[model samples]
Target: MTESAPTPQPDGLDVYVITYDEEGHEERLLPSEVTDAVVERSRDFGINKGSWTIDRIKHGPLIAAESQLRLVNVGSLARAIAGNYYGTALIVDQTPPPIDEDVYDIDRRYDVDVVDDVLVAVVTQRHPAQPAETEAEIAARLARIAAAYGCRIVGVSFALPGGGTPEEMLSHWPEGEEWSERFRAETIETLAGMAHDVKVSIATDDNVTMATLMDGAAAMADYLSATQTGPLDAAGVLNLLRGGHFNLLIGEAESGYLEVKTQMHPISAPGDTGKKAKVELAQDVARFANGDVDAVLVIGYKEAPGGANTIGSLTPVADSILNTAQIHELLDARIVPPVDGLIIEKFVVTATDSVLAIYVPKQPSEMQPYLVHGAIAEGKVEGAFFSIVRRRGEGSITTSAQQIHAYIVAGKRYLRGND
Candidate 1:
């Protein structure tokens, strides 16, 4: 027996979103809607989309600490904008009380969701900050409103320009000693920290990001003392870490799960040039629903202020638990991995009296993607797949059946396509 050298097969994909541009132009800034969808997918499938992806949903929730309200609100807006894909945005600041209908209308027009307490603003597809709203004003206003509304907010995620280097951002820094040089470097690190907090929260427990906030003073000191260029440089460093740059795993256990091995890197959200690190770790648990592995485990890491060459902040580990309860809700298949390009088959099975003929791919590779697309399009899983239902006086039964007429009709079309 012999062991083979490990070849690099991307452990998994990091599907991030890029902004849209004119028909033949480069995509620079993603709209808010697209970002929302990406976020939703990340939550559902463990993938990272732009800074904030998952615009499909009305509003994405971001929990911030009391002391950090100003930046958190700004981040919420940033997330909404980056995810929208279309030039529409809706931002709601829950702390305030007057329901802003105009804002809601704007968000609805562009299919973006921004709902907070009473301050909701819906922005339609348009050039970002067309009338010239400076990032500082926005941040300060949000901070003021949050205070008035009695909500303490902090922590932010989603995408922003690398180091918040846009004109508006640069204009806002206060008069001090050589701020320009420092501003460029510090903003990137700040944004990275914000993104890191968001990732840590979603991937692990909610309180984990908060706990780190308690150590803010110490964290700030360490970060200030570090010799690194800033978060942007840290991102490059993280990539180096990814490349066999370091050879060790670090982290602690989740609330009630076994500790898993981990790795951390500062990878930016898709399309954003910021220096936020994308933390990846390996988990010991396997997610098998019915004697079959469905998901691969990866640990996420975030950088602690000035902590370098050490476990920065340990984001709580998500219990490597499989969503087995919803197994019945999924369209089961025995398809080849999508990367392999195998065929899929559609069929059904029988248990008690009822029969369910599922729409399975004749070729394995075709099945999974088809199911995913169908689920996205139709909300309900269609085609030939196993489903559990509680029938009248029949208790719960897993049944299979065949619709010969419809099946034949669709099958003919399927054959035609293949032919």
Candidate 2:
């Protein structure tokens, strides 16, 4: 038989051995020839408990490894070669690794892993920290970090002890209030505009592991990207609350775009009493319709002593009193030149306590001066026909003769396209 040249042995591969000590010190071994003996020795050198858990064996340019081996059972071979020192190994190869590849496969194959391709940035908040940072500040910092890494934020999750429900965890805040819930909701809302995926999770233990958080974030990012479209839903509102933006409604004064109501007119039954309450609701809507910008009417928050608005008792409107349908019907029926973009939502704080938020969007300039058609109060002249304009820092004031003149002048300027 003709003598055949022995199959050329593949180029030597580089094997790196990394070890970690109990003191958390890391030592990386020099690159050595890839051989069963060298790999076995490396495993022996990196066999400490800490190294076994923390050290990762990574390999790349897998073409050389494949050329050298007859049958490349990458994962098993790597673990067997490393022996007891086998930790997490990553294989870097142009070809995709098997779907069942383990962390040890990092050393055995070259493939693109979703975990590696998608960078996860985690921003953590710990309780009992001094001089707490505001949600805005925290969000800004996270944004900058994500930008630096060119990665999208996946979600916002809370790490709490015992991993209780959001409500249960929030109860730990002072007075067992829902400040934590609101904070979480608000943070989610703020991040929602930036990243599609946002969520909240309670840690199973006191220790919040980055690995667990990254997993959750990845899942949430996938979900948000796949399922959600347009703006956020009720969950988004909760996120808004958690973000602390609701504090704006509770602060010292209401802006022209904001209104706070301690309570709504009680609705006993669907009769004259209910009609009166509906008409009253319409009046509030009309007031905002005439304003220059969108308005937010927050019911259940009342002005307390020292001008601070506090969340008031929710006894005014019974749980069965107003549904979304009734609120919409009332607005459609009572307000003349019906306001567009009015969103009425009810937020239940507790079993016996709840609040209603009426969002009134600004109407066109021609639609200004919206008037309440049916008067709730029979004798009061003010209730029959009125144009209420919100003055900054000042409470809602009825349109005065001077103000009307200014409105006419402004209207003329807008119409003529000149001041």
Candidate 3:
């Protein structure tokens, strides 16, 4: 945590990234890599050039904004100011405010958490005793943070006396018209590429916004339950993978693009287990390859036997339990044409325990409907069979014969007079 990042170079807006993993593993799990924080300049926005974290943007102090952020040419402000209507100035020419490190840390200002794989960071500076916040300051902080973290989505929520929907919340705002029609959208547009999406959600009618006063998790649950409750999208799935949010892969249920297995295939052992393992691996990879985005298959998680198939409990296996070479060999031997860009990685949870992860990236249209070369039947192996499986939400299903016939007919029509 005390590791120092590269110092900022002259003439470029400096950015820093934190290289810490906050996963609450029983033992301080040793991350395979340790990338130190570094400061670098960007073309216009920081997101495009450097990988950054929110914590450093808000907490660390700066010489010329060595600690704080100075946002320029953002949103309508870009039109309000210069360069392109979207990028910041090339130089760090603004004078930054001074701060006390001890006070910033000891004083109650902000708190951060990881909720369901999403970063839930809150600014707590509404009291009279504490100094007032600057105009759109909270927002600027987030832009820098998300850019550094390379977050796909970023959100901020304010709980007022009568907060509700975005419209209702706007109506209650002192300067709703000025904020929504211009400023808010400007901030979002200004920080566009830093995080793929950035928007604010309103949560009022309760005191849950007081994160310091109550349980942060409870406050988060209450604040968000009202605003969003939709299914996981590609961005959400990506966040779950990138963030140290391994809760689901090891101890939770399945969702779109994620499949969990309690044990790896006994491909090395004698008997039908090895053969069945090959079929299972090939089907799993094929199904994910047939989807819209990259997917993950986590081995070493105990899933429910039937019905809902809820995943629970960690069953981290030895490194010898699953071999990446064997998996690649099995897929090539069983799936037709084989899926490309597969990332098979093993993460050590502790000294002796680890989990295996298989990342199946999205395939091209020419490789549509990847097929498994084998199948399992009557407690035996059927090596000559081929099957097409697709993933729908948390479950996988076989493609129907009707769809297959339609594809063949379409192909025949395309080749009309050749026959």
Candidate 4:
């Protein structure tokens, strides 16, 4: 538990991501040699970038960002800040979109669970080449879904960068006034209902073709940065609005490029291929335990068959860890077992003084029923007897000598008592 994540701050913020995208798990679960290597490399990058994120958060008022853009100008600025301030920064992204596509799909995605407690909601609005939905309608839908879940709906907003014509804005934005104003109003309304201080912002670099859009973003960013705590960055600026330090850059850029490449070290086990898998699985178990989750019920391990003397492909243990890591960065305490078909009825888990505790008592009210079996453990049964009143093969009643002696002693005692 001590090694796991620290206690979450109640005052910070709960972020919720809504989208209709689904995470692709096929490559995540099992990868070929090339894909595995890619994963290994990405893991290294994720760790390094994650460290920066932690540092910036711990230090305060620094940007931590990631982007799909090859040359992240905003990331460079954060790096400059860290370089001068003796601080750290986190800038990581799997691709151009720092927010997972599935995480974006509020309609049919589960990644929303990650930000279930978020104090703010940030999204990216792509001014559609053609209009389909209205801003007010979108807001209504968002409110409905959030209220139905009993989750406090703080704000629903998007991060925009500068540059566009008024006609373009009208044609692009659902509301005719301006995208920034419309978004800010909606955000304020949502937050006011939730009884929380809230603000939304947009960002954009000065550009001619997209000047109007950029102006709108800059205006909103300025307002929020002044009145609220949000700031602007090279990325889409959503991360900053989502409570991330406004340092790293997000989104992909065309033409100009600055891609950072790094190598990854493979975790190898000589004559033992299951080591990585085991570590991953254990980490997952540890995280569950840390979160005070009870038992982990595993459907049997999925595996490819092997010959009488060969090892199988894709270790289940490793898969478990990878899956767990995707959900959480750390694990505290959890119960894990290798077997399948495990069930616990209304189990409770608690942690105290760095130790995770689980309690199960053999009370009848809580006991589960079991079918009698032919094989039973010795010493579990108090006694056993068999008798045949009449047998065609001339069988007779049978009892152990010990039982017979006890019966005789009881009969003698009755006789002596003149019963």
**Per-residue lDDT tens digits of candidate 1, residues 30-134?**
223453333322211111323322222234432221222222233323343333324333222333322333332211221112333212322122222222234
Per-residue lDDT of 346 in model 2: 75
Over 203-236, each residue of candidate 2 has an lDDT whose tens digit, in order, gives: 1111222223233333333323322342332333
Rank all candidate structures by their lDDT, best first, as comma-separated numbers.
3, 2, 1, 4
lDDT of 4 by residue, 1-419 (tens): 36987754222111111111135332211111222123221111121222222112223322222322122222222222222223232222333333443332221101011122121223233332222334444455334223322222344333223332223333443555665677656654443333221222222221111222222333333323432222222122322223321111112111111111111112233432333333333332322222211223121122224322211221122221223232222111112222122222111111211111111111131111111111112423111321111111111122346764786687799799996
Would you list the C-alpha lDDT of every candidate in the order shown?
Answer: 0.26, 0.45, 0.48, 0.25
Off by over 4 Å in 4: 1-119, 147-419
TM-score per candidate:
0.17, 0.40, 0.47, 0.18
Clashes of each: 71, 20, 9, 42
Candidate 2's C-alpha runs over 4 A off are 1-253, 267-276, 309-317, 351-353, 374-394, 401-419
RMSD vs true structure, all candidates:
27.5, 21.5, 17.8, 26.0
Q: In candidate 3, where is summed lDDT lowest over 10 consecutive residues?
A: 72-81
Error of 2 at 150 (Å): 33
Which is the better candidate, 2 or 3, if ranked by lDDT? Answer: 3
C-alpha RMSD in Å of predicted model 1 compared with the true structure: 27.5
Cα miss at 135, model 1 (Å)?
Answer: 12
Q: Which has the better lDDT: candidate 3, or candidate 4?
A: 3
